[model samples]
Target: MSLDVVVEHSVSLGRLWSEDGLDIMIAPTSVVVADALITWNVNLQWVCDLDYVPDQERPLDLVAFAAPCLWRRRMIAALVAAGREHRVALSSHSVTALQAAIENGLGIGLLPPESVRTGSMRVLKTSAGVPEPLTVQYGLYAHDRRTPVVDAAIDVLLKDIPATPGP
Candidate 1:
């Protein structure tokens, strides 16, 4: 029998075994860490801006993706652990949407380091209580019955994706 498979993000792997048809899974050895970049509007907070003040403290309006996403979950956990107070100014499922909100001066956002644009926004070294960092894991699931095709596919994937670097 030909096995069907689909690959996507944010899938609930815990429920895979309960399903009838799935036979196998291949996954990352460990979670990948994404450092949050605390970005802000250059125009509003720039050193030369009329409203800017040296060493000023202001309440942070935090922007984040909707719940159930690993990034958002980790961000919240870090904030709670650090005893930081924040208001959720915006919640979105898209990283682009979150970026847009930040660019528009809605609030500071917790985003993947790669997504931050240095040209339009400045990454703050420190915020009121910026969390350490966040990570998310990826996994592949397959049934107990493995075919040659499945084995080959797994082999290819392993070869293509580099192993996670050590701390």
Candidate 2:
């Protein structure tokens, strides 16, 4: 009986948090009982320091969207095809999760450049090419996509674009 709580894409939530300084809770995975007001993601990339593990081989894999990924898989696949080992073992539960994985030596994960709050993560420099960034979109979602609450929430969510560290 309440429409005050709206479900929105993580991108929108990230942007909203950046702009309004509010905290955010990630959307639930493995459930699609409702539709979204929007269905897009915000694009981003993962960069790693070349010297972190000079002799270590990078694994070309993808982290979960729940991980720090905004949209990192596309580039990761290409890297794999090119014989570069880089990517994560699994999608992370959150950006925090992705950062933890990196800190724990799991692998680099994708995230907005600006979102990198500490020296714990750094932008990567490919030996012979520019970094490949991914595009993600944000959506205002609801259990019933046709509801006015969903519509208004979508508008509110789309009002601002999020920021990143940069490619």
Error of 2 at 72 (Å): 5.8
Q: Could you tally the backbone clashes for each prediction?
A: 10, 28
Model 2, runs deviating above 4 Å? 1-41, 49-51, 54-72, 86-91, 128-131, 137-145, 162-167
The candidate that wins on TM-score is: 1
Error of 2 at 128 (Å): 7.6
Which residue runs does candidate 1 get wrong by more than 4 Å? 1-13, 16-58, 140-144, 164-167
Give me the candidate number with maximum lDDT: 1
lDDT of 2 by residue, 1-167 (tens): 24344345445555544454332222322122233333544556564433344234434444445523335445566566666655457674466666666655555656766665456656654653424665554433333324565456545656763422111
Candidate 1 per-residue C-alpha lDDT over 111-158 given as tens digits, one digit per residue, 9 for 90 to 100: 555677565555554443465545444444444467888777756655
RMSD, one per candidate, in order: 8.9, 9.1
